[model samples]
Target: MVLPTRQNVEKVLEHFNRKDGVIVVKGKELRERDDTDVEVDFRQESSFYYLTGVAEPGFYVVIDVATKRIQLFAPPVNPDDVVWMGYPDSLETLQTKYDVDEALYTTDLDARLKEASAVYTIPHFNLTFKDEAIKSASTEDNDALYAAISEARIVKADWEIEVMRKANKISSDAHVKVMEAAKTGINEAELYAIFLNESNRNGAFFQSYMPIFGAGMNAATLHYNKNNATIENATDMILVDAGCEYNYYASDITRTFPVGGKFTEEAATIYSIVLDMQKACFAELKAGAKWEDIHTVALEVAAEGLIKTGIIVGEKQELLDKDVVAAFFPHGIGHMIGIDVHDVPKYCTSVERIDRPSYRYLRMRRTLAAGNVVTVEPGIYFCEFMIDPVVKAEETKKYINVDILNKYKSVGGVRIEDNLVVTEDGYVNLTTAPKEIAEIEALMAEASSKKRKLE
Candidate 1:
């Protein structure tokens, strides 16, 4: 269904807080492959999609902040292009399809811009036409508009939430597919193909981001997406971090499990600890809960788990204070998820990052509120690159038990992630992939049995 984007436009207008000027938004334009005529795949810019809900390229949205009128401008149809690319959507069709008040050709956009008291476009939006009425807005003005739009998106409308849920469902099922198909002797590339087939068969053509089909040591690399390794050990954990975008809304999910369908003793211990971290973070989630405080809950859980496992040798506070724990759980706990995976201001309260090594990548720094959708992804990685600096350091080396750390390093890394929509009381989980050890092992075993019977 076409999103009812007028309400989104209204929200942007309310946030812009100015009635005298027109807010201009540029949509994505069609492009071709470098040095070739082959057209590139088209994906609309998130902000433009939020405003117009028009996925086709070469579109523009002009919103009159005063009257709340939204007009969509479409690329003028060319008969020559139509001969190659079928008849384009007519102006009337564009109007009805996008549910815009007025639909005009690009010919009218310059005139509209020329007539505006001042044209305001969000950051990173380029305006090709020039007019005296287009007085240069200060950097702060553009940033303000960008921030205002981001604030509008921070709390999704009901329809937006539903779209995101649909995306999560597709992605969750895809993860299950990858899980059931994985086994020793299979290349990560094959499993990655399974994930793509699942998403495609379900009508989702694009993944929210690159899929990471990291096996064994590969999982320790946080941004690993090589997806090319072969699983030599059945018990080594494979981390699959992927999701698909549905109708512009996005879902981000991560799941890690053993290729053999049963986790090793060490694997289960680490996996359970990460799961506990997620649960603790969830308990702290709700309106008015501070983002960093929820993150702290994950860090605390990680510290306790590491100590229990004998990988670290210190009290939790001292370990956290000395940044020893950050080596294992280096990234931020989670971030806002929406049309764009890394949806911005990354914004909540205009607060800056804590800048400490532990809080360096905290994406959102504001207190949680109802209607906010976020991911609760807390992980523990054993990548030597991330850990050795601390081990080599004179101050932090005492906390890590090198012998014990090596014993579990083969487990590599484990990350558990889920999408959640915040409510007044708490959050509603949108991810449905089975994260429980028994559930995963059972499903994979069932799948393996079917394959054995077929063989």
Candidate 2:
């Protein structure tokens, strides 16, 4: 059973049973985007997958409160199906694999759901049974079921953690391969393709998001996915921000490396600073530590290093107080990772909003918890366009060491990101890639020399 057969489904059922007489009915692929002329990957909804672990599309699950039983509704497979898309599970096989009480053809879904006094589902949307479910729900009881199950997924299970661990390891290895393959003259896309190939070879059929393969100052852009830039021959670096997914579990990681097989003086300096900040963040991770606390510390450390390096002329406290450090190191320090890179964390907030930490607002905010898996990425880049205004600003003009920062502007930036799982006392780094600059240079040099010899 690909789904959580051990304890995951049982854990969810236990939560659902809290409300007496509440029956949870999860509707199937009411929202599969039709395959069109344009190519698109169809991923199942994360919420649905969490409960049922059913990868097949166009199916629904009903958890009956009265009987304490689970049922799956799927379309019957025809004998001709084996000639085309391979054999699908028979009704008997489906029931056994899912460990459900029964598996019925989709034709019998209505009759099955009709047995329940209430139906729990996501709010009305343009899907197969949206109108029908809404029309049928005559009491407030059904609405409560939807809310209860939706909120139940906020916390992760041990099995879900295991899946994410496997995903993180596979994706992290892909990052290591990309570092070794990068060269100064290679097109940024070339490195991206290598990571993609490696990730797919390791069982990641889904990319959590489009790979960001930016080089030099292009790395300054928070979401640079255009990997078309030609890597400069000297003193430049490549930034690969990518992730892979196994089943639906995702791992997000970013690694930057010197393209010429060695970190230049400037590159090494910037790289060390960011790495130190990341280490500091990792050290503070624990069951109850507020993510914001870690984020604030990362910025302070980066700001202090930037100031000492003469990249910024102002006092460290002054730059920090005014939030000037964001010019070089912006974006969130981390985010929750699970079935989705940014897992459904709405339940953590007072009104179910995605709260963000200061200077790290792109990712959602929450305190560290035992089962939470997240990313810790801290970076520093001298993106000229980004820092130009800060250098030109009259209020903080003295703090702008534009000349020193310019030397490293073309040197690109350094970012070290890893997937981390919060533990009882601290956290475990799930990423398996090498983060040392020397290690990156060694691998790249070895790979490059081999390519040259072959050519």
Instruction: Report the poorest 10 consecutive residues by lDDT, candidate 2.
Output: 349-358
lDDT of 2 by residue, 73-174 (tens): 886666775686598888888887876778888778776665555555544432234434323443354444445554455456777778778887888788
Question: Pick by lDDT: which candidate is best?
Answer: 1
Residue pairs in collision within model 2:
28-59, 332-360
Summarize candidate 1's per-residue lDDT along 89-199 as a digit string, tens digits: 888878778868999998888888777776788868755456665564556777778888998888899999999999999999999998888888999999989888888
Give lDDT: candidate 2, residue 357: 26
Quickly count the clashes in candidate 1: 0
Estimate TM-scores for all models: 0.98, 0.87
Which TM-score value belongs to model 2?
0.87
